[model samples]
Target: MPIRMVDDPQDPQESNNDGGGGGGNSNFPGGGGGGGLFNLLPLLLGLFRGKGIIFLLIIGAGAYFLFGRGGGGCNMGNLSDLGGLARGGFLDPKQFERANIYEPLADDNTKNPIPEKANLMAYAPAVGNQGEQGSCVAWSSAYAARTILEASRSGQQGEATKFSPAFLYNQIGLDGCQGSYILRAMEYMTKQGSVPYDKFPYTDRDCSRQPDQSLIRDAGAFKMRGFNRLSLGDRNDAIDLRAIKENLAQGAPVVIGMMVGPSFMQGMMGQEVWQPQAGDDQMSGFGGHAMCVVGYDDSKFGGAFLIMNSWGPEWGRNGFGWVRYNHFKYFVREAYGLEPMPKTGAAATAAFTCEVGLVQVTQQGNKMVAGSYAPLRSISNNVFETVSPLAIGSRFKMEVKNSTECYIYVFGKETDGTSYTLFPYPNANDATKTKYSPFCGITGTRVFPHDKSMTPDSIGTRDVMAVVVSREPIDWYETNRKISSNPASDYASRVNAAFAGKQVSNVRFQSTGKGTMQFTTAPSQNQVVAAIVEITKR
Candidate 1:
């Protein structure tokens, strides 16, 4: 594992994720590289140029995030003060990291006499200590930065608002050892949201900790609207700083990964401010370490970025320090920022959600009967259910009846992890097939797989179907092609995004085609309900 973390000085064995190194937990499609992958313009014009070949190419390899590739990073000698610095391999699980590099705004401010700067420290949570573990990615993202965003949005502060890095790190890191990727952490937060610190504290490093229903609910309460990566492509330092400052100016914290070596380890300790020193580049690197830029100072250290460290108050000034621009330009590996979703007026967006069910088919004497309901246990908050749609000829459908004008979507995930839109079936005419419908403009139930009963493609194939509704008009073909990178996670993340934090409840199901797939699908705290049915080979 290429892990870069500040080693816990007291515990020499467990290196702090403060230094990038090996270790992680969650599975990755290595997709989420950047928005570049989903360039709407060209993609809209020439979608699936080779049919499914392009998507498969994207899913198979990544120009970035394909870790375990490079080896032998900066060398950090045996350091007793901080835990062992990982030798650098896969530091952040998000190594499949893709930065959304922002272009310089039209009113470029880099030319201003006073350098561009912003301090988001007010919105940030208290500095945390990761102790002797390689969880800096978690501490930086979930524990600190995400907590800041959530607390600011909800106006609920103190310990209750803080998200648990342990909840993220243990699950995202390798086994329970140490190390993780920032991208994986973001995916978890976006798809499942983050639980409060109290629910799963950092002291417990059990990466295998399974969350119960309540924890799952709490985790789903809030999610990032989305994230943007910082790109400094062909830009001068001043312009690059402006883009970063712009995000911080919005009061959103920036998560950063930087190189830490012998000089970094030695110089960072008890230092008022840190700048790259002579021979610092020559020394072996302990590993890449992750941190959060709460603010920046144009006047400090030749225009420095104010950093939040998880090494605790003992390091830096009360768990904070300034890293100069030169250091950032040379050492920093990646940076990503996330925005918060609205707390209200959510209903105005997309309040509609779909209910799904398995249709039991049997021959009743002389007549063939289709559409008998199967049992699905209704969970309180989230839509969680399992059905065994065994054998061939198994039927399924999704019902959406709504007062709101919403668009419905159905997706099918194959055994190989690739997925495609199932409902609003694509037609031959490109112009007419502009969008799929069963548009929820009028009152009445609309069933997906409506044209014909949805039957299992093959018994050996376990097909999973999800019914979803979005108020925003999503180009289904475009979105489907975009999410094909890692359908297992990305597809669900897209649906969760459509749900828009609605609390889902009372999802109903009628086994027969008469009652069909259904749900009240109301947003409980803005959650739109949707569930997946696994077609089994019984």
Candidate 2:
């Protein structure tokens, strides 16, 4: 058996056609040599013969066990729902892993040339409500991001645009009925951007399976340089109140996750200006309650923050009110701010050699399952330029500044356009843990005696991308996969190279990122830092 690097089935960036080549054991119930429905007779008969329960479940759940072997079909909604309320603007605790990857940069004050004390909300449009759905995160985040775009345009907020939370919720594969994480929601907005509310509009039903691209293809969507997590003492601790004020003073509202409890609910319902004191209730209710911090007033209501709640204009002083600073801190859990970027034809193109700050990677088994880029801490760090190509024996190095629980996987592509998984190759196999989940093994910062380097067998210019994820051994599962008898017509045939005898047996090392040092799998609180370098012979 051999392993293959295949393009993600769900991803659209790669071609869907699985090319016609390779041979192996039948990728289906019977030898992949018979005609259509008749070939399934044996499998169907076996289901009735003492395996009815398991057979029913496989058909019922419709889980894609065959990997990229399925045909394009209608995407029914709710089957894949995670029950997380597409919470518009939450910060995932997992993101803290790469928080310290870049050095801190100064804030840009030129965007807000107004006096130090001013409220951008004065120009903001009236707020809307989340209705019965747990979509406050989407509504609040859209409101804040929309207001920033509006202000930068007309220098006022009165005619503020309303972006669609429903569009974001459904398009990003979030379950609006169930509460969602704000940070995850914001990530979608930052990457794909959002459309106007009226275009797609919010609905109370299960999220739509597909987004209407017609509504999303315009230049109206506002894309930020990126979002920022504003913390107080330590990133793991409470958010710094001063930082919140500074961001608000810039006329851009900050998104904060407030703890929703009885007292706070009562305050919003009763008083025009709500201020619930700490310890009003000992019981914790629903968490991930987020709202926009529009502005702060040191003189008004004894030093409080002006908040824009997405409970409709009919609630809380016409959908907006104030929270005393002391009470605000007691309930607020996470804070984030979006730095506005100039509206370009599209997002800035990636430089040949870019130092993308705060790279986050999610680990699944031994593979780096997912990766995303965050804004650089400083504008001066945008040192992405191309130089003379590197030849063979060009040494590469990666240094970790703030170590966290993760293992690094460095991959390279050479001038000849050949790809290689430099580290965590065939050498990193664990034979004993055949059934353990991805996290049930050694996990921590890899303590390498020295920097790891690689040399190319062929000479040419090259570039590299390094991904760090939780330390775990890669696992492969064997199962029946449906395949077309006519391989030329099968799309899965292109990416099913794993089924062929594509074996590589050079065990240079014995573990991927798995090490003897064990660490907690819980979300990291502190930041992690690391860098990738490529040295070419001059």
Candidate 3:
């Protein structure tokens, strides 16, 4: 696991395989040079550029959540005292760590008048402390977003609205206390809204923290519209720094990462001004750390970035200090600019309607009797279709012929013109398991239900839209758990709005006919095995 500055201090261990030395709970895909045997299949599949490979991997891997920690784990370090400047690595999880001694490198005696300077503290709320948890990423991200939200409000300007970092740590599927990626934290705000601190206050970093009725009610109630990625190609420092300065100058607070070491710690403690020298990198020792870059002073200490630490107001100059520009680039791993979603009265009542049709399908019995349905004449287009209409509350069994290894997905569309996942319910068998439908072949007789209800306000005839996806939209399923158990009207509304008209040619199934023996009964040179059946109320 890579040491998170907030987890454990002296004994900083790697949290997980991040291609860096550390202990971790989640598995990094290609950490430490070799990605295990998992690398072989992806590497070979990489040659074939299409979405089918992605779908195959999902089914092949089974349900990672069922076995080990799903996705990679994060290592959060508990930062104690503040430190001054010392050249070290940013949160580059995949880099070599070479030990180096800590020393004072520069004097804060520059007299040049800086032209561009912005202090985010003016718009930000009170500084916060992360306590004993390794959640600097969460704290900094929440703080940054809160600052933007409060600043953007016309009437409540400077009235800081505390957003719950605890809610994000607990709900967003991140490993607790273990540090998480900075970008992931920002993205969480967009996907699942964060609430005011009064709703979900900060607690110790542990999985046992449960949500109360109040917490559940406010979950995803308020969200940021999106975030700006200030990263450059190949982790290019120069390009990233320029983007950071531009955003900061515009009064936007930025979230950044750093490699916390002895000298860096000493500066945070208010012992001395940090002045890092070039080539004194410390990537190996302590792991990654995240903080907010609130302002910049081009004339101070040979130009520096003013930082807001999550150690509360007593840490630095009221929980703030200046860092060398070189150290900012060297120690800062990633930076992001946040934008708050519209919260005005008009924005609240805004409604959207979809142009597409809804679909539903039902499998009546164990076998598809010869007279019940006709066989697909050919698999020419990306989508395969059936002429019959499907009804809501109807049950359907799907079968895939010719290939025993192919996976299947069932989708439902309502009268509101929205689509939803209808199979692979929560705790459902893996797509590769024979007991599961859509994914499994001959032995799979699982039934799919059109459970999504028509909103009382909806006025049109309800219908279901069926789509057979080759790949498992794992993230989709994970985010909207209801899609599996009982599809909700809100889930359909959200998904349709988010993915409307989004072209996904690469994600289609690609097991086409080869040589003389066709992969399927499709005359087209290529074939993507899929079916879209009209669903009506049974």
Candidate 4:
């Protein structure tokens, strides 16, 4: 009852060359086993049944899965490529535990990386009296500390931690000019236990007397001697990367400074206010007067150099400036001292809000013009009034505000009463434009939305004012268009109607008070006046 099994006729031929064989080699062209045509037929049929047909169906299924149903491409690489999936490693538990960390994760659509810190430190005091030569170092040091302390607690809970230069100065009980010897101040601060000198090692002799440079003409030698004598651990002397990074990370204040010769004074004097000139180097003009090392640079300069300044924020770029590598050495040797210590105690805890403001009004015949009124004021404490009666071909400050947003504008006014809006303003809308918008309508008006806007109430109480004096004819067409289309009011009816088609010549100020001011100069100057009016949030 045993039966023999028969092989299927469609089975592949037994030959090695055919790539399908049971035991025989298929190298021969014409073998006794099977003809090439017969072998090809079975092979093709087998492929069609098992692979070609199935492969085509699989490809169609894959295409449908990707394009037809929005399944997305098969990016089978790192899991991180998939949104929110961790590919590198497990998520840090601390990251999840920290409330402030991973804030971007809560929102699925957020693309911005989370910031390391929640808030940055704002400049301290916001405003202070310009310090004298002897007091400058002490003033600057105290200011630096206070600034760092304020910045450190910006995003933390409760009232911001504050520092007082005056208090620190009193506590340390060191008094001398900023250019004077720093050894005394350092010793006094150390003795008072205000700062730890464990990391600082310098005898009084190291910083006591000024270098006798009468015969030493070499700037290099002068630089070397001072650098060598400076104590390694001294906050002013040592370029401690770890400390600097830690302080910045913790929001601590660090002081930096630079050295300059009398040439600095010459540079300042050459300016228009001190001495007018066709072209002058503005950088050398300021950063003169004293030596101050407040903070260090973070780039390739790393902690090698410090940030120093001669004037307040009103003087330099927001009162923030930088110095070169080891530049403070020359100043330290020449001045023979470090910055003074800061004031301590409850005064350091005092808090004050800072605000900036601008007011603009047109001028005619040495008097303010009417319907050309714009009075801008800040509700905050910090206010800087620009040097007013701004000369023709000169610049002035322009303020723009909404309830939630605020901005400052700087512009130039012409002697003939015509004014031109400058770079910063026009570039704000579209950053690519090379030529500034000269049309009065385009330049003068600043629009702000009422909802979530920057308004007078939002700004608080600080105020500043600037006036443009010019002799050119006002561009009436441009001025009228700006006023009419302004978001604040119906300027077409209120302003354009009165002087609709008049060849407006002379203009004057109507009034200026409480976050508002108006001016009436020539049509050209009106543009500047209009800019000032628009800046005021009220």
Candidate 5:
């Protein structure tokens, strides 16, 4: 065997010994000696540990990528494809088409006195510290514009004032913050010109504020604002944009003015003369008051001017007067500015016609029903059927052309002459009242022979009756008293006398098959009245 030399444990000079033994030496590995197993163990362990951790991390990342991303991804492709199914390849085609549409410029001939576009800086005064005064002036200008527009639409030829108290009050509240009031009023009118009549219920008190329960305490409870109170087919501002637009589009005249006196009352009295007209004193019939204009003529005032007024139709030249143009403009700018007209439309008129003819009247107890009988078959023929129904709770004007022979009972309904008892000559004692009563005598103009034997070769041979319907028990005493009370007035008062004491829930006519069965009498009375009739609906 080759000779194997083992180094000594400690030898300074021995080549194998090297003298760098375990004692705390820097060259020592585990024990301060080089090449020791303790030092090498750490390096070996670190290499293997790092490799294991990195492998585990890689596996976790792969798992997350396959499971997490695949499970939660959105289906954007499905949403993107839905546009193909829309009507116009868009979500809302109707709105889209209207959005990009263009409106033609309004005709110059149709323009009103007030300019379509309002220039506040040109007409209005600069706003000063007294903001309220400025606001009031601005509101007055807008009111003037509104009145001018109205007059133009009505075909009223004249120079109208742009400023109006009614228009201002409507635009601004009596309280402070008149600027805000003007804005709201302008917004309202620009949107809708006519405020619903029913909305502002009439109160017994002075016309200061809106009617409320306090005002109606003594008056019977009734709706102040609603469809029932307005004229037929009238809509509120919420849905009447077209009406407002039409009014503004007409290019009506407007004038703004300033009162020189200390108060509105004094200003009207001419205490301090500003723009004195020749007969202005005569125009000041009422106490000192400020008025707004509705129309004007530039030639009359050497240029253009506006009309003004204080009273309604019953007062002051049908509720209108006039003012100068530049003066009115200055007043308007001092206040604020005119508001744009609303984009709404006008109120609808009633389609039905009121005609006179023979209407069958039948009354039973407290109820009454009526229908017109005509030989013709057109809508104008006054014929009604099951489909073409009469309005419920409608007032009627009934007359007694002749009452010499037949005593009218005004029965609510005919019941085989057995179900209910008939009061004889119920409407006979009041012969004078018969002139206004629904139970009129058979006049030759409307009367026809009841029986062929009575009048041979009679052209008009149908006997007409006026019908009244009710649900309560009929009071003969009250009926007769009412019929005879006001004989000179009209037939409506006489008929209303019977139902005046009782509350009426609803009233409708029995439908006739032919169009000739409509109401035959004209609606000329002011009181509540109805024709009486009975018929079996087919």
Candidate 6:
């Protein structure tokens, strides 16, 4: 998961497969080419989850507020659809544990001359509506941004079918019409991926129905390679306009989170450019929404970022409108760009099966998983369900072989709620070297306990595990000491914080394997991959 300079899956340099995306393709009804213009919205995190009989009542009432109240052409959105919009754009660092912040280097401006005006609208899918649901996060990132990237990158002619916003929104939110965070949606797209609209479709209420095995596998094709922040805060919490334009100039559409007042929400349809009039500030009632930036023009209304809305094509100019730079600085809170995953199918790990269990062995030679390990595979999906469990007090060693060799930090919450690091136990003799597990190399499978086999303390003992494989070198003394001190504390966050601002790939699954797991360094110095599993009691 190396960070690419441009909008590329790998090798930032231009390739033959970049495709001709100017075809103005679309799959959503009335959605097609942007006609040289586009628009945006914020997130939905705290909206009420209309449920049971109450949900039907709310939907009925909401329809009136959204449609009936606005008696004319193009309703920007109503209080029913615009409430609680600004809830997902990175309010706290601890809030999104796995989210990364990517700042563009000034060298970009020096090396790449940006166009005064740029438009990715031609590459964008037709406008999509989030309805009354607080799922703008999914619509913008999963359905819109991801759709734009896939359709543009695939070299496919004609319009491209949309990836399901519901596939992401339903899975991430708590329930009903409650919205989700862009961070979660982006992470899901990068790792698990989203199913096509034909598979899951869109829903304004209820979050039931998920991907099946077949759909899950197919989702791999639409997975995003990764995502990076376009602009965060410079001065006065406003994002850098230059960086936003730089990315768009490269044909990369940016997904943004912004605040919207009544002026924009209640009366934005006819405005040439979206700049709030009097009393347009984001007061408590003003909603925060998510949208896509498909184009920008320096000359239009004195510089603007053309936004693509999820309010359907009836709003603005075909659901797209320009926002002045100053207006954007005042309201725009977050902006991000996505990279496409190579169409070479899913990750290599997804193509194979693994078994991670501990065997009561009395020897030590294979420092790695002995048999199934392949030379080419670097990372794997999940090992297995339950490593054949061991009897109480049995001496055992983990028998395993991973295609990729890397250091493993075994930390997990025991069934009783105790937190502990399983792999690198405190080495009293030498704090530098782990007491139980150390040395992540593939010359030969090493000993499970380094010198002796591990024995369980009790018969009914069980602990769920989070196996973290990092490419960054660790200060063993500090990591082990810090994690060991808080066995029952939130040490997992500490382990996670170590990889902040770095690319992280999370693939959690259950584990059933060799007796004792070991540790090693990853093959490359990029991306921290972590997997979670439950330990079955034997």
Find the 10 residues in a row with the least total lDDT in model 2.
13-22
Report the C-alpha lDDT of model 2 over 35-87, residue by residue, as the tens digit: 33333557776666557857755753343321111312111222221232223
lDDT value for candidate 1? 0.54
Find the 10 residues in a row with the least total lDDT in model 6: 1-10
Using TM-score as the measure, which candidate wins?
Answer: 1
* Local error of candidate 2 at residue 45 (angstroms): 62
Off by over 4 Å in 5: 1-180, 191-194, 198-250, 253-292, 311-319, 329-538
* Tens-digit lDDT track of model 4 for 1-538: 0001121122121111111111112121233333323335455556677568677567545644432212231211121211111111111112112111000011111221222221223434342323332333334444444333433334332123222334333333222312322232233333332221122221222222232343123212111100111111212222222223223332334432222323323333222112112211111111223233334333422222233343444433344343322223322221222211222353232221112233232334433222222334322211222222222221122333221111223332222223333322233455333122121110112321100111122232222222222122244334433433433443223333323444123444332344343433332312222223232222
Model 3 over residues 21-69: C-alpha lDDT tens digits? 1111222223332333344666758765688778766854642311122
Pick by lDDT: which candidate is best? 1
By TM-score, how accurate is candidate 5? 0.23
lDDT of 6: 0.52
After superposition, candidate 2 runs with Cα above 4 Å error: 1-92, 95-116, 154-160, 173-176, 219-221, 281-283, 343-538
lDDT (Cα) of model 5: 0.26
Against the true structure, candidate 1 reaches a TM-score of 0.49
Models 1 onward score TM values of 0.49, 0.45, 0.44, 0.25, 0.23, 0.48
Q: Model 6, 429: alpha-carbon shift in Å?
A: 27
Q: Per the 3 Å backbone cut-off, how many clashing residue pairs does candidate 2 have?
A: 22
- Ten-residue region with minimum lDDT total, candidate 5: 224-233
Clashes of 6: 51
lDDT of 6 by residue, 313-406 (tens): 7668887888776667656656666743342333322322223444433323332112221111112343322344445444544333343423
TM-score of 6: 0.48
Each prediction's total of clashing residue pairs, residues at least 3 apart in sequence or on different chains, is 54, 22, 68, 79, 99, 51
Candidate 5 lDDT, tens digit per residue, 245-318? 22222342222222221222223233211243322221112111123333334343333233333322322233
lDDT of model 4 at position 289: 32
